[model samples]
Target: MTLDPEDSKLITLARAARARNGSAEGAAVRDETGRTYSATDVTLSSLTLSAVQVAVAMAVSSGARSLEAAALVSEGDPGSADEEVARELGAGALLVAGPDGTPRS
Candidate 1:
């Protein structure tokens, strides 16, 4: 599938985050207001959060009421938590990409 330029940019950001952190996943989200947030998965022994979840939280904390789009780059599929958060925040779509930034499902 062909992704829009914005979508491709998000994928690139996510891929960079993942590579920088050496994490299992990385994600980027665009808020309705055009602001963007990115994060890598947190895998602490006491707590764990997916990259998508962290990105969503960042948006929320920054006072964004809704999300326009979300992108996740990972070896595995983005989990249900990612989908649920995106849906709850009214994201337009969830874009899944591989570690190499290739669009997946």
Candidate 2:
């Protein structure tokens, strides 16, 4: 599945976060799994919507059993803009899983 516009916004903010933090690379916190994953840390080459789908699929098929209890950004910090993205995306529940293995909250 493709990421919704809200998700796109969130990703943009994430990239911005990396830029602000002066890190060329940073992890996208997976709310579902409370895991920090890099765009290229696994098989994902791009941060596109399609990549998110693939990542989520891989995570589930690879024995990740319970993402419901996980947090989306366990490491890097998300700015208010990012938080807004999440809010707009209705990802504040920590119960909804995104296609990229990130929690909706």
Candidate 3:
């Protein structure tokens, strides 16, 4: 499937975040206002959060009321939590991409 330029950019950002942190996943979301947020998975001894979850939290904390699109670049598929957050923010679909930045599902 062909992705919009902005969506492709989000995938790039997500891939970079994963590379930088050497994490299991990376995610990026574009808000309705055109702002973008990116994050890598958070795996701590006491807590764990997926990259998509963290990205959504960042957008919400930054006062973004809605999201236009979201991308997850990871080896594994995004879980229900990721989809739920994106849906809550009004994102119609969650773009899933591989570690190499190829859009998968």
Candidate 4:
């Protein structure tokens, strides 16, 4: 079955995987009023693993990062709730930039 593009469980796994091996890349959160906020603490990179990795890279590039306490989930679980999983992981929603630098999710 095809997975929902917005699935958070898959996103989390992908992010974790990137952290483990993928090289950390910087993401551009925004550029307005000569000010910007970025998620520099966490590592973000796309090593050609899966769609999830691409999504995650976009999120981080959009300035999303893990909170003090965050819940992590896998797509293998039932009733996979996107927001719920993020809340459990103490993580906030992430925004990833598309090829054109447009924010995704």
Candidate 5:
């Protein structure tokens, strides 16, 4: 399937985060204001957070009250929590892309 340019940009950011941190997953989200936030999986011994969760948290902490879209780039699929959080933030799109940055159906 084809991806919107904005969504593609999210995938690019997510992919870069994954590569930069050598994490298993990376995620990016766009807020209602069109601002974007990106994060990688946090796997510290005392803390474990999905990339999606971290990205959402970043947006919220940055004063984003709602989100427009989200993208996850990983070998694995996004967990239910990822979808739930996006939904709660009013995200219209929760895109999942492969590690190679290919959108999943």
Candidate 6:
């Protein structure tokens, strides 16, 4: 499927994050101003966060008041928390892609 250039960029960042970190999931988000943040899942003994959740946190911490879009690259679907966080931040859509960077959801 054809994707907008910016959206495609998000997927590329997410895919790279996954590959670089050897993580199960990766995610990227674009803020209202077009700034983007990317992250991999965080799995620690005391804390765990989805890739999308981490990406949202990065955007928020960077002073982004709202989000434009989000992209998640994973073998499985994004969890409800991931979707909710993005929505709460005013993201228009949380696009989903397979590990291979193929759009799936």
**What lDDT does model 3 reach?**
0.94
Model 4 lDDT tens row, 22-101: 42422222122222222212433843322333333445465555332222222222123433443443445533332222
Candidate 1, clashing residue pairs? none
What are the models' TM-scores? 0.96, 0.26, 0.97, 0.22, 0.96, 0.96
lDDT of 6: 0.93
Ten residues in sequence with the least summed lDDT for candidate 4? 26-35
lDDT of 2 by residue, 18-73 (tens): 45554433233243544433231123366433222323444455565433221232
- Model 2 steric clash pairs: 29-72, 29-73, 30-72, 31-70, 31-71, 31-72, 91-104, 91-105
All candidates' lDDT scores?
0.92, 0.37, 0.94, 0.34, 0.94, 0.93
Ordered from best to worst lDDT, the candidate numbers read 3, 5, 6, 1, 2, 4
- Name the candidate, 1 or 4, with the larger lDDT value: 1
Candidate RMSDs in Å, in order, are: 0.8, 12.1, 0.7, 12.1, 0.8, 0.8
Identify the runs in model 4 with alpha carbons over 4 angstroms from their true place: 1-47, 67-105
User: Residue 45 in candidate 5 has what lDDT?
Assistant: 94
Q: Highest lDDT, which number?
A: 3
Please state the error at residue 36 of candidate 1 in Å: 0.7
TM-score of 4: 0.22
Error of 3 at 45 (Å): 1.8
TM-score of 3: 0.97
Give, for candidate 6, the lowest lDDT window spanning 10 residues. 85-94
Residues 1-105, model 1: lDDT tens digits: 999898899999999899999999999999999999999999889999999999999999999999999999999987888999988989856899999888986
